[model samples]
Target chain A: MYQIQTPYLLFLGDAPDQLAAKTARGINDWRPEKVVGQMSLENCKADLGLPELGLQEAYDKGARTLVLGTANRGGVISAVWMDVLKEALHIGYDIANGLHNKVNDIVDVAGLATQLDKNIYDVRHPTEQFPIGTGEKRSGKRLLPVGTDCSCGKMYTSLALEKEMLSRGMNATFRATGQTGILVSGSGASIDAVVADFMAGAVETIAPANEDPNHWDIIEGQGSLAHPSYSGVTMALIHGGQPDAMVLCHEPTRSHMRGLPHQKVPAIKEVLSLATTLAQIVNNDAKFIGICVNTSQMVARDIEGYLKKLEDEHGLPACDPYSQGTAKIVDMVS
Target chain B: MYQIQTPYLLFLGDAPDQLAAKTARGINDWRPEKVVGQMSLENCKADLGLPELGLQEAYDKGARTLVLGTANRGGVISAVWMDVLKEALHIGYDIANGLHNKVNDIVDVAGLATQLDKNIYDVRHPTEQFPIGTGEKRSGKRLLPVGTDCSCGKMYTSLALEKEMLSRGMNATFRATGQTGILVSGSGASIDAVVADFMAGAVETIAPANEDPNHWDIIEGQGSLAHPSYSGVTMALIHGGQPDAMVLCHEPTRSHMRGLPHQKVPAIKEVLSLATTLAQIVNNDAKFIGICVNTSQMVARDIEGYLKKLEDEHGLPACDPYSQGTAKIVDMVS
Candidate 1:
């Protein structure tokens, strides 16, 4: 797992400010101190809760990396962005890109980086080959966040759990599977983009053979079992993650599934049963430890009531890991 | 849509005998009259309820087409089989191939067909392009049979329902989505083999412009919601089938999700809720009309007890669609 060697600057070029750049938003929320400050396009600038500066100035202010914070379509870097990168390279900062377009693929940038002796970390590409899963038992603890639906806060739940474990001085690593999570953690694949035939094999590459049985690999999950288009990636993760335990992530007040009004959200108990049965196929004892509710839509008063309701009904710990933290939920497995 | 223009000879060359030839088995069981005879290697020969004969001899016996009856891995054709096809072409048999290898792609065979005026129906390839799903409303009733696990008799349930509809003199057609169904119908894409992105689009093509308000489109389903490796294809089908009603299929005696012993089979009520919530996302009024159980594993007495218990529990209707027939189940939808 590659941790973002921080104090890095958040770059929001021409993107709408505040959570608009999902990659930057994730990094900002998860590790605020690693983000020393912010850089934004003049037209879309807003309060990033940090001082704004140019690439070179930000580097001088202890930003060691120039991370391409926007998820551009097809990862195509525009000519203007190329010039900004060249200038950043001159400022002696390393490059971190999580796009399909590799930084090393650009000849001019590669030549300059070779000249300057700075590394270009292309995070999406895997370093080692992994064979297809034999459903073999392996060492180490694996925790995966299964969700009720897409965008139900699986990533937030996973990151919170990882942070909770790390803060408690235990060894835990967040294994990213999506582009945003890959950018935040600096390793993993855009699993949904992989071909159906090799989806399971690709998942195996991210989960390494481990020596520490207590070491936790909290994997980020993709699409929902309820979602009609993207569930294949989700299944690969269940079989591939071989999670010893899982946390169910969901948004409480969302009446419809994300982007599909005709589809209703899956029942929480139903999704719990679904994920548990699916994961247990890979590991017989695999269990869903708790629930992570995305109560961002709920009002302050309703939040406590909803959490308690889920807890009382399911008889499992439930909380908005972002707002209430994952301490109690993490206790189930830790 | 493309029902096999029949009186074809079942060709099983150097392949395992019996229903082991999935495509052959489907055609033999569902539409047996179309298969005039069979061809087999020395090692694996079985009675096809018709006389076994050589290529020319079978054609002489009034067979117009030679349906490639085995789904080979990677769809590779051995040299001996190529020779057999060449000889079958010489004997004036139109070729119907469902393998990934297009009969038209084989140069000499395609040239021979052009000269002989014999058509090669590459059943797996789509004849026309289809756009991605818009979730648009269309006329007529579409009933898709969803299952608790793959090969949980989803195909059998769907075919039985369609047969019931047809016997009642209602306008109905069975939409094939897997390789066996494609061979049996001479239409439809093996959806799992389709690239993940266009799965829904492929489904849309099969279900085009339904004019009759009372017409029934009974589409065959693949995979299971409970299975981890193949749920994405299932979701694509859910959104793509856009069915107005659905039937849940289950193999009652099976202990776990197919090929996955670690995961137990889902409860019927849970699968009902899962499919209902999922299909309703496509068509809000979509209802679970019936349950189709595969009681092939059960003895005669146990079948009645199981069906009665389920009917008492759910209260809509339940039966072994193959044995008791889909009359009661189809009546619910009709």
Candidate 2:
């Protein structure tokens, strides 16, 4: 339910195309046919060679929806974009925004969208008021990706693990907690955007309450045990997901914490100790299964050596979750 | 700003005198003059040793306010209590509550309070929206008391540290984030009651921003790094407090995590590592200065030997913040 219907138009706005535009890039790569065209007010973002058009013109060309494709730092939509959003809604286009700022929180836009019968999908906010978590053990198999720092390949590791488990004919589903992951899976709450006290509760609701031994919930993690600003989200997931096992995700080439040059990634022993101790609070037997390396930053020649080095250091099978796949990691899960 | 003014009566309702009524106990202990009498429909909570009467009767005897002193589980007030609250307010009693349920959210009660000019202090909710934490280094020294789990002496350690520091002529303040603590200090938003995204921001504001080499902010910790239900609160505090030093608080005799018999307390070394690692996320130079033990459950004979053993094992000074003192801990802080 994260995405709007097909025949979608991408809106990058006046900003230059960058990593912040990752949502648009991911949608184009994953579901290109659904995308009708790219609309940009500034000169076309070079890499997205798709022809650009204004909102109304793009709508006439079979675009049924307008997706806010860029991810802003604070997750807020700029004021200048209000005109475009209102115009798009006036023309009967449903809008989808995957940011911390919900479109419905904007008074006028929500009113117009409701009046015009266009839906506003705020992918992050919880749809239901969840009861507080009980710390009660439930029956199920759950695997959560634990990373050394934010953006150190948690989503990549989780998706790979799900794909690997499915290839082996096991019943596994990915439970996402971030914008990109929710977009990829089509369902999942944005855990970081949730209210603080109910984070664990929101996490507990993403999957079935009853135990199903044959089913595996591969929960996607947000932030890290080492990410200062967002580790609260990580703690909530670790507790709420109550994973039977965890895959340690690490980016070998980064010397410091992501986006923070002054701070360093915790030593593997420390991160593992912290993650496991927190997880054990709910599930006493929860354990770390394997290491999923994000070695994409390394040259191909050095990637294998680094992964092997990790495997040797941690006494666990380690490989690039994306390039080498997560078969080795999945095999270690109970 | 958290407490109602002087001449307030405590409301325990049917709940018996217990540790859960710590808010009432704290008020009676810290500000006896402000507490006029105890109001309970059930048998009087003998522990309070105060006069008992109905709403109007208590109000007639210099009780100008009603203090919701019992910390209810899940922080929700029962519906039956509302009629009583409304009646108390109608009789000119200002209301003060330190719970997750905001008195202002109850439309009828709020409307009545406004009309009667009776103040309703919902102490747990943040007074204003807080900005995202910067993780930028700030002036003045901060010492945070981290615990093995919730109710494991974080408040006691912080208060003891502040008292000890003041005895030694250092300026120190106890920042409260819970009901009992707020009732004692007369300020501080409950970090747990805040929306998840603003927990850290709320912490940052609790301390002064300007550089004061001589002053210290003894920030109180909530929840635990190992508490499945409330670790998000712990993480937010660790990051938001940005403490230069932390004191590990533990109840040595407790074999299991608080209220969680299935989970064991983390080993001393593991707890220290986890705490230092999480704290280091916000301040690279952050370090654990000492250990503050909550030995209330310990037999007197075992206290000295246990403290010595902990000091030897952790390579830091250790003592019970209550029975002993935080002098050893305060000495280690800047």
Candidate 3:
């Protein structure tokens, strides 16, 4: 529910490797114009290939926010990074943090921000009190990507669809629901971090009625309906987004549900069927327009055959949103 | 995860009428031995028919907790009630509040409880970090009371089933998931108040695996799957509770979903079929053992006929759990 001000000064605070700065790289890649430059602490191993600037220099260069774009091993902002964060705040920059350890929880840093009347956006924790969803049909179109299990490529597919639609001159916006997605998109709530009663309401708030009837809101999905732990979030997204069209995302190499070895990944067919039924509760026209497979783990030669089989079996466009672009999938929805 | 210490001193703080004290009445009716006595401030109109007692007197009478069991217009703990709460804490009674306004939010009361080394449970707020549900089969038999809409008697059916099973010398426990149910049962988490990711995990924690293989955990269900506003909570309960048997609870005269004028109540057959399919994700043998109808709005003669029609249509025992008892339904699972 926190709206972050940008162009952002990305802080790659002593990241051990390039992977630790993946969130930073994502922001620079997606919204390059909104990114001012990168800042790195001494001993930082990661680089975003942008000019490095100090807090004052970045602020002078039109950076309004200091984004903690890199992750440490513990997902915490180390004590050594406090001085830089405070300096950024003093330079009239609002801070946007995507760490497990909240900037708002640190007494000194939070108090300083309060004294300066500056905003500190803790993206993982929603500060808004959301109402119960009314199930009222909103104007405009919605597309959601439902998955067969957690970490099976729902977010990737959603981003891909939004990119493809934009390239095709379609009115579409990416609605992020997770931490990395929120940082990448510059605005959106972390849906899974919300209170259980408000999950659907948060989705409704993020993807509200649009005045443009032809506009598409590509809402990012969360857990799978077959996931024992996270299906609640998935269901909330289905009901709240009220998607007119959906894309089933699956990982063919996943032998089990994420983080649970005892639980098997639900079959793609079952997830698609259940997702359609649930989504139709609010939107009678809800249907799966395509299947997005994460074939990163499969042999390169087998990828085409597997996708062909999926398209034949489900009677929908099937593609790997990454290696193969979502142009084919976008053709259906557009 | 806050365990309420009882025999409780029920606090009916200046309730306007008997209905305002419904939660107190429920607690007294379900757990009479746990009720030490009732306490009221000046001009309080509602009474639980228990002897009036002051803070010290109730403590001396073996009351270990002071339960704020009444509802005010705004669901807040009024300033006038603060003295009584503080006095109870001074007298060594832990506090259990079911108000929408949390007791822990009142600095004076919560601080004193902490200083005195006592507990003040804000029952509607969960303080524990619950793990994501594992979907692992637990060693026990469990029954869930699902519904066609919110507030359609899922809690009442669960209580009734627990009562019937216990009376029949069957090992049973009622797992509460809401405010009133928590007060009545004395030891259960408010599942809806939990973080979205932990909804199912909270259910699993409350109705955990038991050493007694024959033990029956009657988990109270939350919102209906067909109700667009809250089906996520329903999905969480289904996947988390993993009940072997489920009793469908519905209000026969209701034409629409609760709080939503535009949405119609789902049909019994549709709801049962959907519930069974979803519940099977965690519990392969999940089924509807019976139907619990709230026929309060129907005429006495029509109630029997309506129930007969339900039983004949669904091939399951049907009854008003309050009026006719859950004997037939329990017989199926027993």
Candidate 4:
């Protein structure tokens, strides 16, 4: 007889007790973990004991999946999952593990990073590759190789060269796995070196691939790269297909940065209009939705206040990172 | 001074003159193409005059982009675009390239395929490769290289591979153009040869990597391995993110196919219920919807009567491909 596997679900929240209760109700047959409540990335990492909480521990405890319910932090919610562990770790100021006795799946709620209208920083940085701890400049070439080690120490390489080609503006996108790699270049030194670097722990960065002024639109109260213009979102949606739910980010506009003048309010409003337009486009089925924005842009008193405003005004669930620990907790559990 | 570019749209119909005018009025400020009402894969080739429709023709005649609106024949409606006219001989299709004259620099339908839950087939056939059409078995190594000449004399190996993968139980639900190709192996030689035969022309096949069936759920009444399960409705939703309409194919159950002696109908209520469930799962949106069944599985007259009854009872658009010329047209075009 084939038994249906039960997937794990993770949820992050500011109040562990309330979140635990809500989660138990949502999934039936789940036991909620105790809340640690530290509430920040740094503090959460410390409380969770990052290095010690590695994959092995969760696997030993019989976890199969996880979910992160980021608390009502200022605006952002962070969540991550190690498919093998099936365990979720939530982050606030502190980290808490084992949200459920046995996690087999996840429900992600970390909102997207909204594009501010202007460039945040254009300072001339060095070209050298930066170390993990130091503030050194990381060379793009060194960081991205064909077969590099992942942070998890897994050796991986994409069979398709589309990523490399995209990096060189040769084409728009690329996706690859193992077998396809052999046919493309027939195991050459340069290809091997590229593959090694890729496996060595290359970072996947999503930046503006093209420069068309009209492509920029505003979300929340700042200017940003329009939803359609962003490569990561486009790629994810295209490859993953329609997700049951999506989290949108509405970070502060570039004009509102610390050094910029405050007269750009009207411009910021225009950007907000664009955000609403994007939300409308994606909100077709009313699937679970959430938004995130920096406090510096909208100046909300708390994360819940901001979320409430978004819900009332745009029929969206919005939050600010300053007061919401949602992203942190979500990240830990996920 | 930079002039804003307006998007182009294409419209096709049975009564080209009348439907074109109606479409123009419905869309507001749009032109229509008049051709014999034939919009199948094979007929599309003829209708578009693919051989003669060169890049210069596309650019000069302002037919680079198009929107097709054929009569909702046999429950299927399709729209595609001529995105990039690389040269007179080569062309590319993008979801964003609607029938409008103006083109948007940024693609609006980047991940549109995820929504429809469908499979995309390569333009060329598997037999296109063994041009002598001898169907003789040969050493797999003897086959042409990656970018070899296909029946169309085009290099679309990735596409051919995608088709073969689908046949071999790979759920290659959707695909689009990018810089590189995603390759798979580890199956066997015969399988590899079949895959190679499929991707003779296209550059890449965008679909989910063939996954272990143990990880997925198998829903029924779609199609057989020969035709495969390429749900048009699913494809539309996934490719466009938001779909304008959908068409579903509902095959009869095994009991119905055997034609055992029975008194009155065998309570087809279950079949109709299953079809509705499948349709809803494939396309959540309640928009234009249609259903089709293979003639071999059920008596066309009886099935038509039952479908009409269902349509009247449920207010759903239930149809079979018995009377319409759409399927015939598709055969002609392909």
Interface RMSD for every prediction, one decimal?
Answer: 3.6, 1.9, 0.8, 20.6
TM per candidate: 0.72, 0.81, 0.95, 0.22
Each prediction's whole-model lDDT (CA): 0.77, 0.79, 0.89, 0.24
Local accuracy of candidate 2 as per-residue lDDT tens digits, A1-334: 3444667788877546567677777767545777778877654343466667778888888887787777653456777677889999998798877666888999999999989988887776756576566577777788898998888888878888887898898889888888777766667788876777778887888854545676899999877777766778888899989988898988878888876676677888778887887788788788998988887678889887877887888888888877788878777763
- The number of the candidate with the highest DockQ is 3
Taking all chains together, the TM-score of candidate 2 against the true structure is 0.81
Give lDDT tens digits, candidate 2, residues B1-334. 3344668788877565576677788778656777778887554343577887788888888888788887654456767789888998888888888666788899999999999998888886767677666566788888888888778888878888887888888888888877777776767877777767677778888875756676889888888877777788888899889888898988888878877786667777877888787787678788989998887888989889988998998889999887777788777763
TM-score of chain B taken alone, candidate 3: 0.96
Clashes of each: 4, 3, 0, 136
How would the candidate models be sorted by DockQ, starting from the highest? 3, 2, 1, 4
- lDDT digits (tens) for residues B1-334 of candidate 4: 0111212222332322344333323222111232112122323321332223333444344432332332333333323332321121133222211122222222333223233321121211111221101111111111111100001110122233223334456443223221111101101111111221121111111112124422111111111101101111121212212121223344443432112122111233432332232223222331323334333456656876877775676455554443331232122112
Worst 10 residues of 1 chain A by lDDT: A126-135
TM-score of chain A of 4: 0.24
Give the fraction of true interface contacts kept by model 4.
0.00
**TM (chain A), candidate 3:** 0.95
Best by lDDT: 3
